[model samples]
Target: MTTTPEGTPTTARHRAPGAEDALPVPAAAGSVAEWTERYAHAVMDTFGPPQRVLVRGEGVYVWDADGTRYLDLLGGIAVNSLGHAHPTLTAAVSAQLGTLGHVSNFFASPAQIALAERLVALADAPEGSRVFLANSGTEANEAALKLTRRHSGGARPRVLALEGAFHGRSLGALSLTHKAAYREPFEPLPGGVEFLPFGDTDALRAAFAEGGDLVAALFVEPIQGEAGVRSLPPGYLALARELTTAHGALLVLDEVQTGMGRTGRWFAHQHPHLGGGVRPDVVTVAKGLGGGFPVGGLIAYGPDVAALLGRGQHGTTFGGNPVASAAALATVGVVERDGLLAHVTALGERLRERLRSTGNPLVREVRGEGLLIAVELTVPVAARVAADALAAGIIVNPCTPTTLRLAPPYVLTDEQAQPFVDLVAALRADLAAEETP
Candidate 1:
């Protein structure tokens, strides 16, 4: 059984007494079976069946209900940058909560202001950059979308979004997301949005060139995180910047999944491949920003655009709560103080090389920047491979049927990378043998 900070035995809400103490128990339908039963009774089925009852986590590892430990490579979808329960983050949150947990927008907290200032500085845009804090990635996009409209004078409300983009599931942000399945269910989304093929500069230029003043903004992900970690070709961001500027449309970069040192840079759009010279008018960030705490923000550069949204434009009660801001401050401090960007760059290169050198026939390609990587297999069995990896005491994810994505914690150790590669190689061989009949 795991113990909390107070040393009290922590039991799963549904697990019976002594069930939490079971360690290294045989892998059976019974272990996860009990969890599935308890989970169904306790929680909403939003995420479907509980894959595993995660009981405890430390650093880059987590233990299941049966006390089997697995190396966590997904890092809670790239949110746990300092890894699970890092003392730095926990202390920051604890101290801030004790001081002041939350305050209304009528008042401002130092932590909130400090975090905003830090983000503006890190973004390195021109002077007078303003930040609007929010509670999630989708909210960040919503804020940005609203800001764009405010700049558009309401006459031009249309937005140009990239195909295969996954902004968020929220109704407003859903309008900008291109996936039909995610959008169809919530039909009649805030209208006046067009989708363009990702990385196609000509398509973007043509759209804006012909649309003239109708498009309010060009919403793009520097690196499409949900579309199997796809990255843009060199100079695509620069082209977008030029075209958006020429057409009087704001360029809003959605760095929700690729920001906060995930791509070895503070933002993936800052990569040299995107010319590294272009500046976005608005940038939305989340995911790794708060290091697991829920925090998001939309940063608008220059006063003309930054001041578009006045006092009554948009607001949220939990948006800039002190606890979340403090967590974000601590996360940003640790990343900068520890030089984690450099660490991520080096470690990510090593991971990519190791995966590429495995000589596994199933692997068609391995590509990514920094820790956000995807291993694409020739076959569409990534879901099975992810399951197999979990069963083998490692945790990974398949963003698509043939693409295995890895976004391990920035604190992942060199020693931990090889075991995962070896495990995947074994999985590849087993799958190949099964197919060879």
Candidate 2:
């Protein structure tokens, strides 16, 4: 049995030991089809059929079970910022785990305290901001939602969320999420919430006007990731902040998908278009924060609202696991030390330019900030295009029927982006041709 650098045990338990290294030259039996069949039997179908059973990854490239190498443009749905098995993240997690793996919330570890300090510092908010760590993006939002209520003293408990916003799937987070399909079946959710059209500052103002002090918070995503990387128009977030502040409501920015340098900024709201030099009261982050190790946090600014959650107000068993904190610290350090934020900015501009240059009639629009990007096709064949791209040895995501999203690792080089762009262009052409007849 061989262990990954992160100390993750890799044995024949998942597949034959060393089988990934000895993959066939031209083709292999361990194709997506074969591995997908095995996955179906062994794994739950929460995320649907496997697009590809990726067995190995390095930087921006991943090899599927079939030994087919593909440029991973999706970056595991924007979680692997430094790409798979980054040495920094691996070493941090391994060393921290060896020294201290986990401790109950009753007792804190240095890694956990350090991670919280780092996140709060990175937020650059006032000195009194506090942090609550969680295990996933949903948990972060859930914790933040609770904090909002605690601060409001239950008098103002209603929340105003954006129409296309995706906070999370947990009960509390789902309360703020606006998708009918995701929310309807799980009705009788935590109550007192309203949804408004995103980027419509007028509508947001109207909602607060109607609700008055009843609104506890306005939860929003600086850039809607699950909604096909949709971004708010300039000054929308600033307007929300102003309206919420005027109404004595908290402005919660859900940066689960847009934070951690994904959008060339520490937080997407830091963008000139979004916050316009404003600061939000609450910010929730996850995804790339740990660079693949699950870690999420909620940052509450100022003492007025920071200490709302007193003892026994909130807790989690594995929220601030030492190993997870260590992983996040390492990720943040690398991002800062290597200056990846600027890298993402430059590379994102190049990627967007190349994608537009494809000039395919099917591409209706291409939009996104930094490494997080999306291409909207005129027709609703994004799933087919994604599949075609996979077949052509490239990986991307069909976020909507007509929109394809790409969130490649920050480590992705221009050389990697070029071929992937070419492959997407070719796939668009092929799909267009197939539809012509």
Each prediction's whole-model lDDT (CA): 0.85, 0.85
Instruction: Record all residue pairs in model 1 with backbone atoms less than 3 Å apart, i.e. clashing.
Output: none
After aligning candidate 2 to the native by TM-score, how far in Å is the CA of 408 from where it should be? 0.7
* Candidate 2 TM-score over all chains jointly: 0.91
Model 1 lDDT tens row, 1-437: 12356432232223323545768744333565687787899899889997898866777788887878889999999888877877678778878887899888889999999999999998987898899999999999999888888888888978899998988888989999988988998898998888999888889778977766798998999888788999988988888888888888899999999999998899998888854678999999998999989999999998888998998989999998999999999999888877889989998998899988888888999999999999999888888889888888888889998999999888887777777889767654457456544
TM per model? Answer: 0.91, 0.91
Q: Say which candidate scores most in lDDT.
A: 1
What does candidate 1 score on TM? 0.91
RMSD of each: 6.1, 5.6
Off by over 4 Å in 1: 1-32, 429-437
Cα error, candidate 2, residue 349 (Å): 0.6
Candidate 2 segments whose C-alpha is farther than 4 A from its true place: 1-34, 427-437
